[model samples]
Target: MYLQHPDDPEKGEVSESDSIIRTYQTYNKPYELQPEDIISLRIASLTPAEFDFVKQYEEQLGIIRKLNQYNQGTQDGGNQNNMRMQGMGAVGEEGSGLMPIMLDRQQTGFTIDRKGNLELPEIGEVQLSGLSIREAEELIKSKLINYFETPVVRIQLLSFHFTVLGEVNNEGRYTSFDPETNVIDAITLAENLTDFADRSRLKVVRFSGSEAQVYYVNTLREDLVSQKGFYLQPNDLIVVPALRARQSRRYLLPATTNIIGVTASALSLILIILNQTQ
Candidate 1:
């Protein structure tokens, strides 16, 4: 069961002084992934600044183009793959018998390292660090054809996991299923962002190659929704910020103290004047 620290909600951050409050440990949070947890995903609430960062990093990393090609399917007819139907004997194609071979790279339970590479069993070191699941499958199949009899291979995104930190219901890691997974889908899987989550301060931190980049997404406004497109790559990290209540309270405290001080001064002057006149 995943337990959230109560002190995490208060000071906007979990402070060292909050170690005493252990109320969440009593509930025995469910061990399984709950639908409610996804809503609090980091991408749901992004700040304008962070959004620009996301755009900048994506532009440099080729994430945008890759995602588009992945979704739209290549003009070269990659999407026309009828392997499933061919395997079922709906239509007989060459190597149809071997089509039953499931070698979907994305289907494999593995995560790409910083270099965009995966370590396969017999294949040894297969470089798939940046390529999408579909792309990786093609590379693997092309290579495996030499060894097997009409090698039947299918690749899948076995572990589509990402981490979400900061102001959300369940601020931890969430994994997604293959193909249907996306940014919004992950957030939905995390149970959606909480009301106290600052929609204007959302961030998506990701590691590209050996370096890490942070992209900002905004949930406060809707202008950029169309531009976000779909699907999140593996190793993405989202972070939602705390609400403005803490800042507002900090500002009000000093003002209230000043007002009280002014009122006392005015009263003292009035008393002085009265005494002088007497």
Candidate 2:
């Protein structure tokens, strides 16, 4: 149980040593923007912090921006109840709740329509689906050129989330704000695994369009950092199976207790009969 993660890698050599090596590797494929994905899109102009350009565009473009959809929402119930919409503004200084609310990763923010189009205040609808975060940012910045000389745009993906099940303390869908979420970070989010969790046989199931890939990992090894499953993607499912002994005990302990109880009852009845006879 205490092995793997050798101090050195040599031909035909192995050692059992815990390592604290920190090797950060980027994901092979970045998550592309998906339709119906929720993202916090912030647009700010340098020097003058105001949305005066929006009013001008309304008259010039003859388009109406239903900005009330951004301002007039009492955080809905469920997971979004705790997320507060503060300092909200289309574009302004501090305390101005402009476009994009940091309300939460799952509930609040701009939702891309099913057509892969994101509707903005001035730029109307821009196709953001199938584009990476950096690509989307540059596209949005280009669209803002007609409005301001220099527009600073920030797009934070809030729809990145994963699921944890089996042996974890809290088994549910968890939101990860960081783009590079590791398996260890996910375990911590689930409040760590249960006592019966098998540290050596952790399973990571990753799903693509119509295919699912599974990976088995040992949480105790230092080589975990170099594993392909180290960086978790959206919709990844992590399952920490229980040890064999733990699974056996689940069935064995209750049966053993029942046998002991029956034996005690039989002994009590025998003693009562002997006392009556005496």
Candidate 3:
């Protein structure tokens, strides 16, 4: 996240740590936070429960990597490897543009069509409206197998993503195939919250078929990953509320009220004195 140092009058770009140090210096009026001051920021400091949730995705990612390597002809020499190669060759002439089926990319909230089908070049209209990218690939490949021997189809989610807004540095939409991304990822993609962001008042808006649901997430105390309630779905919208300055408003309110009251009292006194004199 980008931030400005309180010491630096120019307000140039600075890291989150630097900004926090400057804030400490400004408030405490003690030792100025220097670059040499020791500091560290890493996920290693997270609680065990938090680490478990984060590592769950890591293990899943590893398994997905293995599966991809196996599917992409990366196995070492063995019976299983040879059989896989033979099966691939059984499809048709190798690299004839017939074996590899390329599917059209889809964006977030993209529906197949009115008929709930996708039109491929040779295959024509095939059902794939509500299926995910992986599911769509499997269905397409299964159908192609009837015509070809072993069809290898490549599929990708082109527009599977949502937008994050409000008190964030970079507010925009980001794409991802993994459906596990939660509110934290959404905020992280927006470069985290600004210094004046209210962590306790973050809001998430999700649009369904004919309605939208709104949720409030407290970033300071909430468990982002565990709370599936705040997890982002396709086309979800996140908004971080700006921090309301307590002193500025609270102090000004009573002072302004007193001033107005005093002014009215003075005006009444002046009117009374003028009437008596007349």
Candidate 4:
């Protein structure tokens, strides 16, 4: 039921102008890292001794994560086996009693601690929170100069996720590698908005520090493309509300149809009974 606007304007209608020009320019803007943000840091051109020193810690972390996953799997399997031996119970009883285990096995990325600092292999702890991606890369590069000759430092943000809810065809959370993801791009990921979606009252909720900001968008307007809320940030949520007419059709129409069906059936039964009795 999702509808896409026409790519070309029809005859006698005004052409759709570009939305990018009206919206706040986001070109060349880098996203600032925050606490709990995961980032991938790669260091190259290290001497053999330096490589050995860093490799040791990396291997240790990898081995520890593998062991943890193995232990968790073994424990879960043992519990399931015990339940099976005690007469397998109901169909979903075993799984119902067991809690789902979520494991964070990201070995390559560095997680920013609550203190907004990350402790590297040899570079030690560096304050990274509130710094843009480019700034973080330069800061880490400067720190590496003390150890390696012309060290190549590459930094990338690993967590860029957003959510789309309400009257979308497929409402769910999605991940994007592109930092300049727009509102249209996010909606496209969810298979676009449903026909019943209220084009005049779309909402984008964004969090900045401790404050939550909401931006209202009108998709039907020609200037929607130029709105500041068009460009979505990490953890931003886009909600498309349903039209009032669509809501009535969804809830009331079905009940009305059911009532009409039951009344007609009862009337037919009564007529048949009268004919038989007469």
RMSDs, each prediction? 22.8, 8.3, 22.0, 8.4
RMSD of 4: 8.4
The residue-by-residue lDDT of candidate 1 on 79-131, one tens digit each, is 43311222344355445342232223232234455555554445566675445
Candidate 4 ranges beyond 4 A from true positions: 1-29, 46-60, 77-107, 220-225, 258-278
- Rank list by lDDT: 2, 4, 3, 1
Taking all chains together, the TM-score of candidate 3 against the true structure is 0.47
Regarding TM-score, does 3 or 4 come out ahead?
Answer: 4
For model 2, what is the alpha-carbon lDDT of residue 256? 95
Candidate 3, 77-114: lDDT as tens digits: 32342223323344455743222212222211122555
Whole-model alpha-carbon lDDT for candidate 4: 0.75
* Stronger candidate by TM-score (1 vs 4): 4
Weakest 10 consecutive residues of candidate 2 by summed lDDT: 60-69
Query: What TM-score would every model get versus the actual structure?
Result: 0.43, 0.68, 0.47, 0.69
TM-score for candidate 2, residues paired by index = 0.68
Task: Report every candidate's CA lDDT.
Answer: 0.51, 0.75, 0.55, 0.75
Q: How far in Å is the alpha carbon of 34 misplaced in model 4?
A: 0.9
How do all the candidates rank in terms of TM-score, highest first?
4, 2, 3, 1
Query: What is the C-alpha lDDT profile of model 2 across 138-214, one tens digit per residue?
Result: 99989988877687777888888799999989999988888788899999999988888998889999987799999
